[model samples]
Target: MHTLIASPFLDDHLLLRPGSTQGLRIGERRFKELAAANSPCPPWLVDAVGRRWPDLQLAGRRVDEVVLVRQASPFGYGRASYELNLGCNYDCEHCYLALKKFDGLPWPDRKRLLHVMRDAGVLWLQLTGGEPLIDKLFPDVYRLAYELGMMISVSSNGSRLPNRSILDLLTTLRPYRLTISVYGATAESYDSLTRRPGSFAKFQRGLLAAHEAGLPLNLNLIVTQHNAHEHDAMIDMADRLGLPHHVFSNMSPTIYGGAESLPAQSREYLRKRKPFTGCNAGHTFFHVDPHGQASICKVGRDPQIPLLAEGVDGLARLRSIADKLLLRQGGCTGCGLQGTCGTCMPLVTLYRKANAPLASYCQHGPDRRDQQRR
Candidate 1:
């Protein structure tokens, strides 16, 4: 196992652990020196943070042998998310991925993609999918990414957490965090929502195993019409685990601009979002699909770059693409409320393309504030 990761986090640099949030900020000169392949472990670094990596303080150690030093890149992305595979075990009515097809690059190509992401300066990587934990290459992928020194987080439904092999892998390498989506508080509601018998039982067991194993975990409270009544119960469950939980009450359209998933949304739970402030989607962070297509963000997948073919060099075009896609040149060109619209242009474009009812995303469609249920 590696001691610690020293890497550039955008313009600044950070020194952080694999499974823990504890970190220290360092200067550019220190970062550059540490990044050198043959430099000895700096005594100051050992003195400052040796307790975190006890072996580093034990005399002479080559920087490259113990520490994982991430090289800098012109792309400047600090974070990136990859869909290991779109295949999943459960079939939920509200899933945004319209097609739950099983497909991904082979192991060799997957390894190459990770290296490219590393070279592009992605220090924080998210592995998600229809269900990332079920992917055949999950263990290998996670191991490689961890060895490469990326802080990895897995988004799963929590069904596989109880598996002995899975538990062992996670307990061994450890992840930055596990974000498990909770569909309902009870088995009846959960099984119904997931459309899979015994899913709820497996989920409960998984939670217990993860808690017992001392893994870092969080919860995503998924609220739909079927599970809306148990929202408070879900929160209580998460609170009992002593972990943070977030509520996701809105059902978004499919990635293909299809509106089928919107029907499951809990109307009473719908609330206005913050203003559409600009973001660094294609700049500081980018998203990769199951096939290695790089996009500005999850919602804006079109005009993506094929990372497998073009490699990191393709990311150079992403910023201009983001600028062009975010412009109000289509249906939103003449809208008077464009300035104060709550949603970003790419998301709005999807809703419009789907001919979604205005009440779903448009601010003028209904008085949602009056129906606040929280």
Candidate 2:
């Protein structure tokens, strides 16, 4: 297995260690020079290899053996996320994907799509789904992406982490991070929130097994009415496991403009989000759904680039789409508080499309009140 990767990330070049967060930015000229050489790498890189990876030998090794160098790409895409399939085992009312369907591109098309992502200059890729591990082709998809030299991260509910095949595959390939969502600290709350009996048991077993395997892990505490009482207990759970955790209190509408998940919101935990400071969604990165539809981001899905139908050439028009979508228009017309808006325009647009109450996402929502009145 390669210990390091020297790849072009968007406009910049990066040297990253697989299965870990270690990374070093390399100058363009130095990277070009390294790529030109055949064997017996430079002193600084060799020394870095020694210090960075003490376990590996530092003999007459070629740069290719220690570091996999990627050629420069004309397209500027540093990262991307691919939803393998929308199928999931748990029925969480809080899920953003209200209509979770179990369908995706066939094996050939899936392989083609992965290649498209690899060719698009995606260095860091996220393999997501309604639940990625549950997908029948997950292992194959993951292995392909890993072999293509993309540092990967996965977002899952931790239900399948205990499966021996899944565990062994992960242990071997080793994703950079596994971000698991925790529904509740207790079985009752957990199963109730997921609406699936014995789900909490599977979740617990998976967590313990993954932890024991010494895999890098992250926890997302999904705060909802059913699980709110155990919020502190959830934090304690993460702490006890010695894993980093984040709390997601607010719920958003489904990608298809459904309000089913809005009822699961824990109003007490909802707080004003930070101001949107612009993003490089389409320019620097993009999102691809299971069927190979490319968009600027998950929130902005209109006018998608059908990667399979249009192929990689379709990406030539993505940056322009991103520019148009980023503009705060339509329902946001004549809005004065654009500067202090909490959510991005695309997300705000979804709420509008769903015909959801303005208070759910807007800064001037019903929740905001005068301090004197309180």
Candidate 3:
């Protein structure tokens, strides 16, 4: 039986299991409760409770109550998000990854990254890219992830897939998820977004191949101003293809390929399309640049603090660094959508720079007061 402790210092929504501690600091109320309460519940009961209520709304944000523990993983199963490739093959009019050039990691750095993930007790990883499959090094990286006992998940544009041999290798490697983005409903719409003439066919075949290979598939859809009207079509496509749609609006412009190519999203678009909760970038997850610089999230690149150094001590330093970096000092500071909107600090930086009002890149613009008066 695992004893669970509820912090009276914080709201009842947050709980701490005996072995599993809070990654972030608990509120004062939670701290007091934690101080007074000994282990009052077992792991089994806590797990049961989590199953009954998976998402706990705290501070107006939703987080998974139960963190799934990988039984065979001795390192305790850490979470990591790896930028596998930097180049995107598509040129969608509103493409995010396309704004940047694709840069593949050198073999040495790749190995070091794998070692770091292993040392940090990370068994699950999110492998993202402009288009991971576009790079030949992807298989090698995936192999390295498997060698290090990490369950890999690739977030791709569904543009390319591995051959049978590579697919077989991935099968043996056994990743946790392979998430692909489905951008449009029709070929015209898809190709228009991808900026490729025959890309829709290629992606369709890729999705089929992935499905045939028995890979667990998760589909992503960026609900944009241009595509929002076609939301039902996108959902139907996901359903027909037997994929779960993880839909969301645009991110901050800082994530755009470069500073020069930032796309603007309107505030109205944000209000209509975005979720109420803000982002979990620095709080729940951090971002690592190709140069090995780590920050709370990819939005704001603060060089003062990084998760790891060139070696082992780096891994041990991340959690503390993450703790210190809490409470971002940007767009979210006093924004109405602070907790609900998924905007990050970097996006805020770019947004403020582009428009003083901080109009969301994914939303519509607000009507000016002078115009209203006129």
Candidate 4:
């Protein structure tokens, strides 16, 4: 029997059998008793537990035989996201990674990296990209993660799933979730937003193929000024297909640090009305670039640490960076307009570098004292 370790970030202890995807969640006290027994457990479990609680000690000869290893920081992560590649067939106006060059790691390296992530206690692995399906090695990389007992989520534009081989792969692997981005409802509106003449048809074909194959799917309706009018239509399309859909209006700065959607109308429609304090990035979530640079989140301002070079040590650096970024700084600290401010510190820093005024992104304008009073 293998003992499972409890993560401090999590309330329950997850116990697993060797080479199994499923695990049993037990209480912390029970896990401690198991650990004290010094029973043999999977090396990855021991490594994960040790990271979560450094003060833990095990007794008995089995403990002496066990080899302890560390793969990630003490602050264990529950989910990890990898931008499998930066290449896409369609060009969407609201794509934040539009300017990033295609720089996916090779198949062999990607497989190795996945193993490292699995050992680091990442249960849910998200494979995303300009379009993950566009990457030739995505199938092999995905299969390896599945075999490693990691629940996988894929983000795609739904242009490639129509292919027979791709559909077959999905049916076989059966990923935990597949989220497709829907730009517009009609072919004309969709093509306009994607800037690709035939992408709309491709998306339809892909959606049909996925549905036929019984793949678990979700739709993300990206709301931009270009397609805002088609919002209801997009939902109708999802409804027709009997699929769930989510609307995402907020747009972030481009990967190149340019505010692509800073127009007053766009900002006004997408601005948040909350202080936006809660983020799980450095704590239980992280994003890895195609080249293995890890950061707090997809749009976080923390410096990207090279995951390959630093391995789990990179997570420690990420936590530090997150801590620094979370502190209210500059104009954001004690700002009454925070509740209505769309811009955060990271965004402000990006805008500052781009020489764009914060007011351009702020929905409440520069002087909101009257609004606050009201």
RMSD to the true structure for each prediction, in A, is 3.8, 2.6, 10.1, 7.7
Give the number of the best model, judged by lDDT: 1
Q: Any residue pairs clashing in model 1, and if so which?
A: none
Candidate 2 lDDT over 260-363, as tens digits, reads 88888888887688888789899989999999999998888888999998887899999999888888887565566667778888888778777877777886
The parts of candidate 4 lying over 4 Å away from their true place are 1-9, 13-75, 261-268, 271-273, 337-343, 355-360, 366-374
- Candidate 3 worst ten-residue window by lDDT: 61-70
Task: List TM-scores for all candidates, in order.
Answer: 0.93, 0.95, 0.67, 0.78
List runs of model 3 lying over 4 Å from the truth: 1-77, 256-269, 272-284, 304-309, 315-346, 361-374
Model 3, span 1-374: residue lDDT tens? 11233322112223343212132334555444434433443343444445644553123221222222212222232466777666777876555444457775687877776776566555456777667776677788887776554556778877677456656765666566788887777787777666788988888888888888777788887655556666679889889977788776554443542433234332234544454344444443555565555555555555334334555344444455545444556534544434444444455555566553444442323433333455
Question: Comparing candidate 1 with candidate 2, which one achieves the higher TM-score?
Answer: 2
Worst 10 residues of 2 by lDDT: 365-374
For candidate 2, give the lDDT of residue 297.
88
Q: Scored by Cα lDDT, where does model 3 land?
A: 0.56
The 10 consecutive residues of candidate 1 with the worst lDDT sum are 365-374
lDDT ranking of the models: 1, 2, 4, 3
The whole-model C-alpha lDDT of candidate 2 against the native structure comes to: 0.87
The C-alpha lDDT values of all candidates are 0.87, 0.87, 0.56, 0.70
Model 1 segments beyond 4 Å from truth? 37-40, 50-62, 366-374
Ranking by TM-score: 2, 1, 4, 3
- Deviation from truth (RMSD, Å), model 1: 3.8
